[model samples]
Target chain A: MSDSEDVLATAAAWRAAGEPVALATVVETWGSSPRPAGSRLAVSATGKLAGSVSGGCIEGAVADAAQQTMRTGSPQLLDFGISDERAWEVGLACGGKLKVFVEKLA
Target chain B: MTPALLAALQAAQAAKRPVALLTRLSDGEQCLWPDAALPGALAEAAEAALRDDAAANLTLDGEAWFVHPHNPPLRLIVVGAVHIAQALVPMAQTTGFAVTVVDPRRAWATADRFPGITLIHEWTDDAMRALAPDARTAVVTLTHDPKLDDPALDIALRSPCFYIGALGSRRTHAKRVARLAEMGHGEAAMARIRAPVGLDIAAVTAPEIALSILAEVVAARRGAALARRAAPAPAAAA
Candidate 1:
């Protein structure tokens, strides 16, 4: 199965098990982004995860955003790029920029 | 991201249907294209995204929408369990194809030769019937024997499979074409077969041949402008 399928399946399974779930999707990408648009990362309330938005460059930040989205039941559009202040820490090594949309599963 | 919508999306992917999830980034409002026919630019964008198996971000009426295309996994059906297949299978898998090897020769089609691949111990025509090659599927007949390759080609020609390649030299292909013609396949249909079954890379070894074949398959899938077949080597060169 493709990563997209696995991520969606994991998100669905987490929701079915009564654990709150948040889905993070790469909505836009520029330069040499690790993943393409629509690549997904699923985060569960219990900290389980599936798939990735970047090649381990910014999953931590996205996961934190996901948790916040779960708490607020609101979606967030996150922009990450080398120009950001946190670029040294969370920016992609390939120097790509991406926008991730995170939302809780209703 | 309602539970019902998620379930529906999963169901569509599981069924290997081409689907697009359109999300308006402003408010997380989502709808699946084809749930209802989309209008204007959004519809064209979704159609292109699905066709190219890529995602796109479009601004329609000044509202940003992301169209995420979930296309079915690419499938390859190799109608031979030969040496080139051994090399081609792994390469194709690495290139993201779910491959199946169909051959009745139990001795050649054993797991010892093609480990971890779906093996069908049946005639090529019967196997192709059951597989039902779709637009996402590619069919390659590596068996030199006409009995095996011809049947598969006949079936593939009638289906919507995107790629059909047969392994042979020019003379061998001419004979195969004549036979297929007798089998009622027209000239247009016969044109679809990529005989000599690879890019003209002067590949001699089995692995090299496999690489060339896989390259051609990729080219066909991407709708690349394939180079015209190179003429056979000059007789004086021999």
Candidate 2:
């Protein structure tokens, strides 16, 4: 995972340009997860992103979530708890649950 | 993307600093995972195998490992409530350190005394338990009292805090050595204790002493000592 400085810096630049940005943090993790709790990846309204929530599988979805947060100006808590249907979607073999907290900040 | 993250992580890793990433994953109003409860762990054994199917099966440890490219903060535990600690705390914070201070003395160990510090008004063990001191943690005990100093030294010697120092005069330090020996501490462990803490700067004031101590801590952290300027040919051995 990358440092938050770049993410914060870009977010500041976005704010200066009257663009919205969101910060996502993994406050807590359980079982076995790729990233530890407190990992952050920030996204801007312009689709600029820094850091990663998951190794790779989750960033695309998270970037999507970030854009949603930026547009609606509302935060979301996305869960990757595998459902029966989810089994066919992507191989989330790890039984550990990821409680991702996404938020937008001024 | 700014390479700041990689730079910071690489710098910290090279300097032997333990760094943790704090992300803002989701938030109310505008959030990534709204209603996301913090689980603190994730597991995916089946997914791992399936995903590997695409890129040739490779054995990977199922046990949770730190995410690649993620660098956590190094934890430094300062076990004294002294003036030197006051300055050192802020400096450590500025330089990207997760610092904690433990002291039982009421007058010395109060939150107000250390505004932004993770000041703990408890014994060393309790704080260490809650925080779980790691190898990247550096333990510095400044109080001369055995009550505050000894137990901390005990915990630090056993734990992985790279730098462990206790403040004392040479005589006081010698006495401390004797006491630890009496208490069944071996020489090897005692080696970890840096008595007469701080560099030999002959600092007489609090701030100066603070600078000396932190200078040593910085050096110890980087595994480099401030190179002493060349002496003038040693004066021909006097």
Candidate 3:
């Protein structure tokens, strides 16, 4: 299938399989985050997901929150910023904040 | 290896296309091991280990579960056969999105002007099957007519179409929402419809507006690091 069809089908299948899946979206970003506006990540209850919202900096945090949202069916807005205090060598360099609005799919 | 799995891997290795592998990790589904680009975002050794144990990793919106990274191209789908589309289509196409412009107006969607693009002169329903709008793809309705835009948005939101934008004014957007209300879409769903689409940048001409709109779409598409960093910031860091 095409890109659009592929993503929809993948997401639908994940939902239909009873997998608690949450959608991660880049609502707002600060500086030089890896992914872009419509970039999305779908995380399953099993901690499996598709796509990328960042190069990889905030994936771990986003996945953890998405798993929580998927099970609770509660949408959550997750924010991540690269800071020295919370300096994660694996985090983004340009120090931008990414707001990922996660929602569970029933 | 299954043909589908093999093709997906090949696509990634060759940069032909980006495909996601959806495998079931729990017993709810029959997915034993998903041999994805980032099968649980594990290292090659770790992913192989997951495969041995019949487990799978997670990913979405470019975030992987384990720890690996893979970057792919953006996909933009434009709906309409208008002047804005004429500008936006090619502009976005150049920006690396696999652009496909869908319109029932054959006269306007011909290839003479939109040469390399995947132009579809068909109804939205027919084209949507192929155009599967997702978080990676931006769906813009420039038809300016609700009959065309509304139906497309209806299907778009139902699917994982991430960015659903329709061209109109703020007043037009309010009016459009009222009409959509009759269709049973609640405020949340309506909120997803970015009417009066594009950035707040002052863009008047077709080219200028097209650039601004595409810029916003890119802004919405990029990750926090790349999108938020202003020009000077990245330079300073460098």
Top lDDT: which candidate number?
A: 1
DockQ of each: 0.54, 0.09, 0.03
For candidate 2, write residues B8-67 as lDDT tens digits. Answer: 544565554433332322223211111223233312322332223110111233322222
Of models 1 and 3, which has the larger TM-score? 1
lDDT per residue, candidate 3, B23-79, as tens digits?
221211211123433333334533453233222344444543322112344667788
Quality class of the docking in candidate 2, CAPRI style: incorrect
Ranking by lDDT: 1, 3, 2
How big is the positional error of residue B190 in model 2, measured in Å on the Cα after superposition? Answer: 1.1
The candidate scoring highest on TM-score is: 1
- The Cα error of candidate 2 at residue B172, in Å, is 1.1
Overall lDDT per candidate, in order of appearance? 0.89, 0.62, 0.63
Q: Compared with the true structure, what per-residue lDDT tens digits does model 1 show for residues B116-191?
A: 8999999999999999999989999999999999999999999999999999987888889889999999878988
TM-score of each: 0.77, 0.51, 0.51
Clashing pairs in 1: none
Per-residue error (Å), model 1, residue B152: 1.5
Q: Candidate 2: where is the Cα deviation over 4 Å?
A: A1-106, B1-68, B225-238
Q: CA shift at B217, candidate 3, in angstroms?
A: 1.0
Distance from true location, Cα of B237 in model 1, Å: 12
